[model samples]
Target: MAKFRLLPDEQLARSPFKQLWREFSRQHSAIAGLLIFSLFFLLVLLSAVLTPHDPYLQNDSLLLLPPSWSQQGLVQYPFGTDDLGRDLFSRLLVGARYTFGIAMITVMGALVMGLLLGTLAGMTKGLKSSVLNHLLDLALTIPSLLLAIIIVAILGPGLQNTTWAIMLALLPQFVHGIRNAIAEQLNQDYVIAYRLDGANNWQVFSRIILPNIWEKLTLMATMALSTATLDIAALGFLGLGAQAPTAEWGAMIADSLDLIYIAPVSVAIPGLLIFLAVLSVNLVGDGLRNAAKKRREN
Candidate 1:
């Protein structure tokens, strides 16, 4: 008889959180993106606490003041004041809150709905799958921005409505991704073995298929976050999102467009923030996908 030694729990199952941290640290671009995102998030969370002045309050006398480091500018307005004399720095901080809020809600809503629908279609196959797939194809054929604009038009403009519009625009992408992942999972040997062991369809799907495809779904969610951020900014530029007095990044840019020549940094600040945010999300998503692939390979 061969003797076997039991492995410690730590050895048997490594900490996934630690593994994830390590993987994230290995990717320089991902680390940079994460740091930028973290800084943005800190600004958002501390906006009310750290902002030197109320973002909505206006001092007509101080309008169009250049950034603080400029020769004649004051320390109170680090990024400067907008046309309305509101603190640009404060507004930017608050804007981060709105931008992140919309992206998160829209992406999460789309992910949940897409995952449920896709899993059902993939597992069912036959006529049901064909019908669902056809519908997905139709949705994919339509321009996401156009669809979002129409949805927002009908719903009218507000933060919640904008999020819903974004979710509708992004749902099709998630649905397609989930459906393909699930379909692939169904053909795996583990699924076949589970089916042969007299496991019911629900059990096989919930236990076997869902777990296998979760990583891919996570990557899709991260990508959707980036897309939703851009979509929200576009909507704001079109005068259909976040509305006035909200201090949203997109709305800030739209409000500052007239002053672009005189105070270009006003427009540039928000645009730069948006660019960094989107780039960060994409980098993080790509890193996660690569990390997951490596883990599976190992």
Candidate 2:
């Protein structure tokens, strides 16, 4: 009798979810990131119900207090107050909701826009492909942030415009990634096999090529989500994102800049939250990329 195990081909053909989970779980930093992100996002969701004070409430008499532990700080406003006495703690929590929510919406918009454009270009050949490729190449000449700023300027500054601008700016990269991924899949043996087996274009693409390229799409989506967060924050800081009265991390940071000396925590808290949000997204992206890589290597 001989002991037997599945060969690489058999293993690769097995259900992907278990393998993906196994690879993803191997990354300790990613697990830590998931926990951190969950905690913060939960705070964002629960902030409205849990806040001790209204984030927008202003009390001139209690303005610019430091953290409660600090000498001049008040106990009730544990996290402190800004130049205008808005609750730093409450605003920070609410800002998380606004910032993450906006980023998600922007990423989803970009995903759909990119996929359509990329698939159209990638699936075509000759003149049509050349035209679309040239268009995307021309669009890529300018940096995304610069393009976003220009778009915001043209569209007029506000949350909706800023979101659209960020999505538009991020679309090029996603399109490029998707186009290249599909182009590569089109050359692979599986696709050729399906084509030769009397499978129509739709059947081959929808059944084989799209499924194979899904991992790349997932990676692009995560990267797009993180990029959207940064772009939104940048726009907010420049006064082009969410308007005043909206609780957003970058906007909060801008409002608190003048009080950095009097109460640095006001600036620091929002800044840290933004940083953490980006970090968590990147960590998860890294885990997914690594997992995908591991599968490919195996």
* True-structure RMSD, every candidate: 2.7, 2.8
CA lDDT, candidate 1, residue 8: 55
- Write the residue-wise lDDT of candidate 1 on 111-175 in tens digits: 99998888877888589889999999999988778889999999998877888998999988989
The Cα local distance difference test for each model comes to 0.86, 0.85
Q: What is the per-residue lDDT of model 2 for residues 1-298, given as tens digits with 9 covering 90 to 100?
A: 9999998657755978668877888999988777777887787678889888999999998878789999887888889888778888888878877788778888888988998989888988999899989989999999888999999999999999998898899899989988999899899997898889999877877898888888888888877777888888888988998899888899888887887887788888888888888898889889999988997776
Q: Which run of 10 residues does model 2 get worst, by summed lDDT?
A: 8-17
**Per-prediction TM-score to the true structure, in the order listed:** 0.91, 0.91
